[model samples]
Target: MSTTTTAPGTVPAAGTTPGAAQGPPKSRRSRRPGLIPTVVLLAGAGYCLLPVAWVLIASTKSSRELFSTFTFLPGTGFTRNVADLSAYRDGVYWQWMLNSLFYAGVGALLSTAVSALSGYALAKYRFRGRESIFNILLTGVLMPPVILAIPQYLLMAKAGLADSYTSVLLPSILSPYGIYLARIYAAAAVPDDVVEAARMDGAREWGIFTRIALPMMLPGLVTVFLFQFVAVWNNFLLPYIMLGDDEKFPVTLGLYTLLQQGASAPALYTLVITGALLAIVPLIALFLVIQRFWSLDLLSGAVKS
Candidate 1:
């Protein structure tokens, strides 16, 4: 048979010619979505969410029903439980709620503001001791809360601020972790050219910071605020050591107090559980509310040109 020659640069059909250079192999089509990651994620979700579900159901239960009924079973004592909580120790639970709100809300807001300002300064300004200061702050982050707590308490006592609202609120105001996050965000999100341009245009430093930098750093600030909020809200040891008065207690300490008494007075167990459920509602709601404002893209910042 006579042979026919192909074009020199002709690619073999399906690119399968022996000894030919090949592109990356085509990925195989999966018949279904990945099962292992899905299973793992679902397992993790269930593990976290199951306790929340238990609490919700348990809170609805009457004391007797709580012990007798299946854990997941619903009960009808939710209103009564709320009433008992309200009536307990002259409605002290609500005071704890308010105190928690103040500590977390005010503390987070102040911390975010300070972190934003400090982060921006560190990121944009050329100053002596910048790296040293940053390193010190970072070191603070590594230091355990336990290490600082007693010293903080002692200092508060010296200043006569201990066992007061200032004792709890003041210590939480400057968060090294928040500063670290803010510094990273500021560096990533704020461009040097923009800062220079603002300066050249005769904008004052504060003006540039408040008007130009703040908007760019807003997303990161919101993240900082949320993190600090959760931290302050969940903080137990600081408030526990600082405030001796029950009236000044945050919800965390209040819950701890209830839990302590719960060992002897088992009836307080339901109240503790109920209060815990209530405590987390604000966090969840804050998350949902903040979700609308948080932009992942902005936080990631512009890709390198």
Candidate 2:
């Protein structure tokens, strides 16, 4: 082969010279951070977090100090608030917390499993009415829980499920959004070749799904679990409509009751604020524990299947 020589001090085209500049360098505008986006994000974070900060501070205040002192001022009632909340209704606040944990934990687990299996089948299998089924599921996401709650309650009442744990739970187990996420994740994270190979090895379909596909799809499943967990934990409307007993109440419902009581007795204002502050501790702890399972790569389809 003949060697190609380029003009002196000039960048050569590909194959003309080795290690030559290909094009002009990217501009400073392209490399530097976008100022507007950064400011907007900071503003959004502050807006969301400001109320939480207020709750933390306000929980520390006694009912008298709540209005008397500055908004951000710390009072000496932090421990006292905990004691009062603990003593209220024979520590029913803890019962509500336990109920919420049970509901969210069981609901998230069941939701994640169903979503994973449904998503995998939808993604991997070729069946009739598959798209229609998925579309119907997605339609549920459009219907807000507020609009659906009354109807759900009526149905539960007809089925003798009203005022029962099943009424609150069964409705929450099927998450349209979680199914959507799982489908996307399964499609992205599971390889067709791997699935085919498993089939050729005399492995059953369920075995392939449980052993081979599930491992690859774990990150996405974790994300679904997290979403459903938060949704069930923060849920108010379904429980409000379904359950009549205070013993079965979740933290959200319990707080609403306290607020109603606080309207009559201003002393309960401190209890309400303190309960609200304590309410978020579990979620914070959960985030710290499961933060690693949340990956942009899995969500954005950046990881190889």
Candidate 3:
């Protein structure tokens, strides 16, 4: 074989170059989502939205139109339906709405206060039996609400408080999950050094908590408050088990009783549909209104400082 000498620093041809026998560079391939994932997500959204869509359409139909027409079609009796609902039993529906508001608003406020206090202490202080206390409270989360309702009703009865609004309101003010959420929020949001600094400045424990800690925990407390509000609003079993008087009924129980009566009176069916539509309106409006201010990051125990 004849040797070929090249100029200094000159590149040789591909086949002639030593150690240049590797394969070509691989190009990146497009990654398209598999068909099943897209379909499942779409299906889940459709499933959740189905009832809401039906309720909207059903509210518009007259008693006759509701049974006569297809489920999705709109009818001409929307205004008449609302008027009829308003006229029913001298507008007892509005009373139920007010009761629901009172329960949610007052109960949520109290629950948030309790949760904030307990959570702040639990997170910031190292006390004896802290783990035990937390574990006991967490056990409440596992207990079914139905299981608690019976005993709560019995206790309220023994206290002569049953069949009263207090029977409903009192039980809702202490939520274990709310406390848990508050603890997580406190641990994540309030810095220990900040608290130490406040203490060194001769601030009382309560003063430091009220002025400094509470403002930082506000975002988390708001979440706890909203959760409690919705829980009280949507609650049916507790109120149903505790209160017998229709006058004291919350909207959930009232609407349910109305639906039960629909089996005998189809006319009430229309009222039930209309009431159901109205019952969810405030909650939807509340979510829309507060969603703008709600800091969801606090829910997961993360804050931007």
Per-residue lDDT of model 1, residues 267-294, tens digit only: 9988998898899999999998899665
Clashing pairs in 3: none
TM-score of each: 0.88, 0.86, 0.87
Q: Give the TM-score of candidate 2.
A: 0.86
lDDT of each: 0.91, 0.90, 0.91
Clashing pairs in 2: none
Error of 1 at 223 (Å): 0.3
Model 1 reaches what TM-score against the true structure? 0.88
lDDT of 2 by residue, 143-222 (tens): 78899889899999999999988998898889999999999999998999999998999999999999999988988888
Model 2 misplaced regions, further than 4 Å: 1-33, 294-305
